[model samples]
Target: MHQPNKIAFFLFFILLIPFGVQAQGHEVDSLKNELKGHSTMDTIRAGLLIELANKLTYSDPNEAIPLMEEAISISKKTDWTLGEALSHRQMGNLHYVLGDNIKALDEYQKALALSHKITDRQLQSSLLSNIGNIHADLKEYDLALENYHSYLTTSQEMGNRADEIKALSNIAIIYNDTERFEKGVSYLEKALSLSKIEENDLFIAAITNNLALAYKKLDENEKALSLYLEAAELAEQMNNKYIEASALNSIGKIYLLFNDYDLAETNANKALALSKEIDAVEWQSDSWEVLSEVYEHNRKLPEALDAFKKHVQLRDSVVNEEKKSELTRKEMQFKMERQQAVAQEEIKRQQLVKNGYLIGAILLLIFSIMGYLLYKRRRDALEKRKLAEFNAKVAETELKALRSQMNPHFIFNSLNSISDFISKNDIEQADDYLVKFSKLTRSILENSEKKWITLEEDIELMKLYMQIEGLRFDNKLKYHVSMDNSLEPDNVLVPPLILQPFIENSIWHGIAPKKGGGNIDIRIAKDGTMLKYIVEDDGVGRSVQNREEKKTKDSYGIKITSSRIDIINHLKNTKGSIELMDKAEGFRVEIKLPLELQF
Candidate 1:
């Protein structure tokens, strides 16, 4: 259950957001009467119109729409540029709240274009965040990030602590959504620290609330609850219903977690009343969900069902299915393009293999003809030539297979995740991600093009791969890398990018689908003249996983790895084999390869 936050950035004092109208302690009907009476003063009328629009934005957006349109037209006719801009900006926020992302973007752009007419850097900065938020909602992350950075940088230049914290908090939201909770927590901590300096109750409540949510995602419920309590108290002191309601709803969930039925029910109902008081549809939905959970666990089946139905009704009414479909189509198209690029790369590799075979045959034929002409002296040359041709073909095919081991989707998603850290101002975390990303990419590029790499390099590359995957899974997927003490990894030689596929299989197939996440163990030990590499996971057994995979196609990586192993066995005069076992609780894979050493 998630309570909603306004997508608009907090307005700075000196330069009020063109769209901002803090109409507090005033009734909507009174504002309408004021709008009706101030016709001659276009500025006053426009202001009243915007105030009504802002108030209705969260409650009854349908009525707010025509009011904002009338305000903009009247303001333009009266040559009130700022009023017109404010109308457009507020209109954008209204659309965002209603889930009309396309119209939201258009209105935000119009606001931004008009922002150039005014010298209010603060309003302009807020517009950047509004633009970024809409882009993020549409899953256009790159554009969203660009605007968020602009928001942060603008506030930093202006030295507004409030705006800076707002930017940080919002950027952390993007991180939380992307499952980069560790980095998200870092960002939230920074924002919370800065906000504490300001001693602004409303700002403090907002940041701590976000921090609580980030901690909750990391499964640190105690920390989450503590922060939520602090946020609730701060929000109450400021008489802010939005923050107070959000905190109460979150607290109710925590209570549910601890099975405190009475406390959960009490807090959820309080939050529900507050949400309804403010006409916060999203928070009202969240309240219903928490209440449903409390009822369900308390064995009040009828109440639970009723609460659930209300929650779904609100959620379904707010979410626009057409926008969801459009976003899905865009995502699908992007994936298809990426897959096509990978396929085209494979085609090139296949053509290279064909060329290698043709070239090898031609070379062998030329050598054989020469050997026949000088049969007495070159008898040994023919045998050497034949072996060279075979080795070359094997190496070429192995190279192609090695190159295929790095999935483009994995690389793109990893890189995309890193950008979230940057936006949140968690530069340290961003740097750490970049380091791991650099190691992974460099290893793939360098080793895939090589015939063999030191076992030490191979193990290091595998560790980096697992570390990156561990981050993707929010560290819920634990992994271990260990080797026998006697095995000198630097002296031992192995096929390049060899262990990655098996480890990847354990991660994606074995650990990832587990409910609470699982662990992977990669260990290497000496077994006679061969090195045994074991990959194991505490997840669904292979038998169960296979059963679940009935409609899914088999992985081609395994086939490629098997073929590469066969080639290595024949060329190196060693036995190599891979075995997959379905363990009682999970899956285990072992790869046995003859130990080859470099002098």
Candidate 2:
């Protein structure tokens, strides 16, 4: 009984799709005469052909085929894409009504491609809906939902209330067919609201009836009965006998469920009369099903058997139509596969001819490439050797220029310290500072010729320089140097005197201005591919130093050191940097350089 109801429901949707033509108000003979009056190969003739064909699509679909084909031909001749697309879509509708879904889908697809080319949103939406209908009929629910959603979105964008209601209702039917009653109810409710807003009596009656069916499936029989009654009343007011019969049959089913035999019999008989008037076999079958159950409940065995027989007969007719549709689908599929096989053979033959020429060209190209690569290899090697030699010489010259600037800057700062000690009348301290400075100067000069020195060697040179500064402060400075256990200072190389300037700044500026003096800490650690160095001093921080002294010896030393580090970075192609930050009580400096290993 429910199967017939579903079949009857889909049969009604055919009238909703506006395919080939809006020819219902005109007669077939009149359209044929109008088409005959225009015999020229133009869009007017094409349109007339489509209209006449659509007029006969239901009555004589076989005869309408040639008319649609001629319309398509004329549309092509006139370069009218819209006409061609509509004709193809109408052809699809004819095939669909004849139960050949495969051919119908093919025609719809063709029209869809043409519609997209012409940017026709209305035609595109209709084609999507048609494609979805075919997928729904074939029980491809996922594909059906996908296409239906696209149609709904397009309709919403266009603000077409009628199409929007149609999309919503179509989607609801799929959900209901798939047994997702809750989702079906949601879509149908939205569609019902839209239909009422549009004041379309037919749509309202159809949507109300579907909504009731969803309620019945959910076991809400009382609500279903009320809605079914409302749908029947709406359909009757609109003079829509098919929807009226559907709603009445559903009402009868509900009454039978309640065991109200008299009312069930009355509603079922009324539904049967309406279905017969409309020639709706499925609805008649549903009515008979309800009556058969009602008769059996009343213990009327003869009447029950007769009603059961009628129900089975009508059900078989519906089933036989479904079988015919399936057979037609299979026949069309076989024909399509056979045509594709022939096309594939032609493509393969063409490919073989193209491959023969391609092979000869590839062989010749390979030989030419081999000769070019051999010559290019020799020329590239020669250029690479010359370029390397020139770059090495340039790096050496730049390194010496940077070193020359640093030596003079360092000597100037050292001489200033010596002058300071002597001015204070501290003879022994001055002499001691001069001796230590001389030794530090000797070490720097020795390492200056080399581009890089071991970390251990550089740290030793720093210790001597700091000791010299300690004498100037009368042993006021305290310092400590630490190295990570994972690093071997002797194996790592850094530029000479890279850390001296920052250390000198920490002592004179960061530590000397403080009341009790301060301590300087130097730390070296392995940081991935780079060597990390941190130099921090605990003293009267930079803020205090800025107030006391405007110009400091360390500033000049730091400028020279930064320039030297930049040169080292350019030569080595590494990112070496100097960063200085102020601590609450002092100043801190961090330096990173490429971690080059000697061994």
Candidate 3:
């Protein structure tokens, strides 16, 4: 996933400036000789220093830094605005290559300010591109897009097709980073059209590769493959080994995904060789990663392990350097900002001291207003605390009332079931049912006074109730309860007897009315921040039950349960809900409550 954009990022960095470090080394040396012979702090010397620094920006950034600083100083002394702006922009490029994004941004902003002062549209566009690149690396997509748009507009106005292509490609990369591949494709197509018109093979190769990446992300693999091949061919023709290696590595990865291990390995090896030749460590790392997967899929375990180790080593080398550079940039930025803030505070303090009488009166008025606000705030806090406490007490009282109403109603149903068992001349079963009923009653009493009980405790009470009822129907009332593994029964709490009435109603109104009786399934699981309870019975449905008993007492228990849930919703300020559905063979009831945890 990260491979494609990283390849595009490499291309963007290389395309940022026109001059190549190794190709211009002789030119840099000649400029240095000229500067030494001239030995004058004029605009020419400043310009020479800036040019030399630009050449060394990538090859030896540390050496370039002093040269850039000297050029900025000399340019300011000579009133050479263009020289100063170029010096700052070059410094920005050097910092960018070094991965010091904060410093790079600061330098770009300084250059941008100078560009505006001189109305240098070309320089302004370049600075905007540099700033956009920094923001894109930082994942500030909005700011990156804003700068890129400005860069595109400036380049178009200046009739610079090359810069326009670069701007479009950069904007496309940001869209890709944000996972908006369609938008990325739109921009890349525009860039590709412009590149082809200009007959720029380098731009063509890079844009084609980027467009392929967008297609790959969109799952248009066949299109992606064809474009990758074209990009690779173009890169080979131009002798741009970096892009060729990147395209080959991407091709190898796609082949790996397709399970074509032979082709994957072949492409990976080719890419690795090209990357090694170019000293492109990141691309070499990517190639080794593809090879590792290919080897693993082929069951070449030892080779796979070796390839994997090489990939990790190379990747960590690049990643750790980037991390360290980022940390240093942030630390320096924080210190600079802190110093500026402290200096501003000192200046304000001095100003206040200078205006002594005005300061004293203002301070007195400020203190008086603060005192009044504190008094009002304290009063408001007291009122809010008192209201909260009162609401808590009311909620507790209401819960107790609901539980009191539920318990007796629940006991009456159990007692009535026991009476029916005895009336059917089942004396032995009635005794057993009574014994279990007493145990369940004891458990219910233990939990009655509490506002909430652990799910484990509630389930235990439920199982006992079901057992007593199961005995009444000669074990025909079967039930299964299951919970999600992600939930800990002992740690999760529910309102005491909250689910009892629903379970009771399912047994009496749903299963009891069926011919051969039926099964009940209880499922408890987590639903985001809510707890879900589903009670379903494969018995007579609600429609049939309503037809058989038009005025059932179980409806009373359901109404009470609904009222209790409404109170709970009010107390918790949550959207706890209950849903009832009538299946063809049975009835289903789903209840969602605010999940409460003990810890």
1-599: candidate 3 lDDT, tens digit per residue: 00012325645545444465565777878988998897888888888888788667656889989999999999899888988988888888787777666777788889889989999998898888877766676666898899989999999999998889888998998899899999999999999999899988888898899899899999999899999999999989988887899899999988877889898899999999999998999899999999878876775654655686578568757755564544454454454455565576567556655665566768877567556755765675566556555454444444444454335555556566656665676666655765687677556656655778899988887788788778767788999999999999999999876777777777877788888888999999999999999999988776743654633565665666676677678779889888888788887889999999999
Scored by lDDT, model 3 comes in at: 0.77
Span of ten consecutive residues with least summed lDDT in model 1? 8-17
TM-score of each: 0.44, 0.56, 0.58
Per-candidate local distance difference test: 0.75, 0.77, 0.77
TM-score of 1: 0.44
Candidate 1 lDDT over 504-582, as tens digits, reads 7777777777889998888899999998999898986567447547214235677777878888888778889988777
Q: How many backbone clashes does candidate 1 have?
A: 0
Residue runs of model 2 more than 4 Å from their true location after superposition: 1-26, 326-353, 361-599
Best model number under TM-score: 3
53 Cα displacement, candidate 2 (Å): 1.3
* Better model by lDDT: candidate 1 vs candidate 2: 2
Alpha-carbon RMSD, each predicted model: 19.5, 34.6, 20.0
Task: List the candidate numbers ranked by TM-score, top first.
Answer: 3, 2, 1
Which scores higher on TM-score, 1 or 2? 2
